[model samples]
Target: MTEMTLDPRQLGTGGLFTAAVPDLASHEAAYGRRPSGWTRSPLLRELEASGLAGRGGAGFPAWRKLAAVGAGRPAVIANGAEGEPLSRKDTALLRQAPHLVLDGLVTAGEAVGASELFLYATAESLPGVGQALAERRDGPRVTLVEAPAAFISGEASAVVNALETGTALPRDKAARIARSGYQGRPTLLHNVETLAHLALVARYGAQWFRSAGTADDPGTRLYSLSGDVPAEWVVEAPGGASLRDVLRLGGAEPSSLAAVLVGGFHGAWVPAEAFDLPLTARGLARYGASPGAGVLLALARGRCGLQASAGIVRYLAESSARQCGPCMFGLPAMATVLERIAAGERAPWLASEAERLAGLVTGRGACHHPDGSARFVRSSLGVFKDEVRAHLAGACTAHHGRV
Candidate 1:
């Protein structure tokens, strides 16, 4: 598939708006060099003080992450592993604006006093990033590492683990990769888009960068909008913009809306009536959701929310590495129950089983899979209670025995 070109200005400072870059070659020229303003810039310090969070789903503070690996011969990992099937923004950015991404990685390494740069990407994305890196001979020391294609393998720590051990798998502990990553050296891991933003911010300074986004969360973000949307493409928008605005940008029909799933499979389902809600880490939390990886799956009115939830559950279950006991046993059982429920089977007890499984998996795994799965399933039950009740009453009109 030919990669779409995005306008650098679309990635510009005015909140989230569509800008087209056209193609890779054009984007490289636009990327040029690190903005001279970044030299001796205190933006990283301000970003730390400003509490800029990771846009790559976790929402962890960027400054804290950088601070975690204080001045040293640290290594920087530009995590470009876009694992969610629904998310294409990261890979799209890499393929289209590889130079921008490379510039960000180099600038970030320089900011944190890191000497080594490792750009970790899925095998599918390796070629694009590698080519981009090859064009740059004046940047910081760098290497491109291809990670295995797996769902959870793209998590920040997982990327670090894979780079160090040459294994594309998540570790069995909540290991702080910043403390000891990449040959037991302090490492700073960030999403490709996040670093790209850093490159610009480092050049423009915080005030100039802050002019485009919300006060609390300053900057633009890329969202992957799909399902029942007319304009199903990656969108660039300002942080804390209303969800309604994003939906409109995606060209979603008013009648096609039912509930919108913010975040990915691990996110929550908010009724479409609440589309006016702002899109922010804290705002989504008010609705019992996190913008996990910036995926917005809009379900149409006729679509069965429970069945949709079931399909996602099955996917998450199958994606599990099976390293943790709770995730191994609980996710499969939960998916089975969701499958039965989606099939219109009268398994009232299955709901209880899902709840029980959620309890077991919430915080018991080495990774966030179990927690994420629990959130996905638990939120489905909460959001689709009426549907579950209808299925139990043998009156489910959606997906009757289709599973």
Candidate 2:
């Protein structure tokens, strides 16, 4: 596994992964103990005022998720299942700053009057998280479960499913996790990073939480920066940070980039021309991208974007839960077409076929798996139009043999 790297200068002061806080004792010493005894209303108000959004993609307001579980003995889950292949931020946080996440989990449980608390994470992160839990002197007991390595396992519904049914597949969309979750209780599922931010918000209040980022997007976010860089680095960036600056922080030269796949395998591509834009949802909207889980995969100048996209799409297609026709049939079909296109298929209708298949699979799954895969495929077709053309003409313009 690639070791996660951090740069304090890029993180600014009081960022999540500080050098001062390595162990549980150091964590409490640096940030002080988490203040206890919060009720629903005040906590929700503070979270709303903080303008914090979910870091686990979808960008939903954190307060809204909490509020949705109103008037119930809800379950709170700290989700550290970093299933995205390019994402290491959650894992890094869980390993290096486990106490902070534990504090958040306990804090959220208190605020919501939770009946039970759970911490779900990747296998590699379990030992550290378990150790951190052992060190806590006065927090609510938290149950820890090892998360499966599948890409879809981290989806909100899927996380609930895994704990309840021992299956990592996503549950039906009709039953929202907040309304009906594990063991038929209202559950407040938050990404581990989101929970960590909640811990800070609980301690420092909304204003302090909002001190770093923009008015619309407050607080700092950990970005998993990789591809054509010196190494995979998990760098903390302020919300709505410039994409170019983030890549530079990861040691990527702006000029050498062909494009970036913002978000993870399910995300869209933004060409090099738009690298200067902010990483916020609003900033990346025009390019059909978002800061989904803060995953930024840079495409070097000589790489074949279509080939790179095809491989990811193929992986996503195979990663499907297969409970829906779109995932079971449509995604594989779409992947096959995309793979053909990447392999320099001269058929004039190949590109259109891929689009047709994307349209077919989109929004027709039991989950958003098909939709996200479609978005990735569609974005590739648009961003790599030149490459598509070259491949159709029996040539690969990127000259790297394969992307």
Each prediction's total of clashing residue pairs, residues at least 3 apart in sequence or on different chains, is 11, 0
lDDT of 1 by residue, 1-403 (tens): 2222233353532222224432345553454446643432365576764445787888787777776785567899888888887887887777656666777787778767787899888777788676766666666668888877678878766787788787777775566778877777888999888887777666655665677668866777788888877657787777777778877766666556788889988889988777777787677665688665788898988789988899999999999888888768899999989888877787688788889989988889888889988988989988888788887666664444333
Estimate the TM-score for candidate 2. Answer: 0.95
lDDT of 2 by residue, 1-403 (tens): 2433343322222445555336776777768887898888999999999998999988899999999995577899989888898899998888778887888899889988898999999999999888888787566789998899999989988999889877888878778888788888899999998988898888888998888778867888888988877777888777777888888777678788899999989899999889888888899888789998989898898888888988998899889878899988888888888889889888879999999999998778888999999999999999999889888877888983432
In model 1, state the lDDT of residue 56.
Answer: 83
Number of the top-ranking candidate, with lDDT as the measure: 2
Name the top TM-score candidate.
Answer: 2
Candidate 2, poorest ten consecutive residues by summed lDDT? 4-13
The lDDT of each candidate is 0.75, 0.84
Q: What shift in Å separates residue 53 of candidate 2 from its native position after superposition?
A: 0.4
Clash pairs detected, candidate 2:
none
Tell me how many residue pairs clash in candidate 1. 11
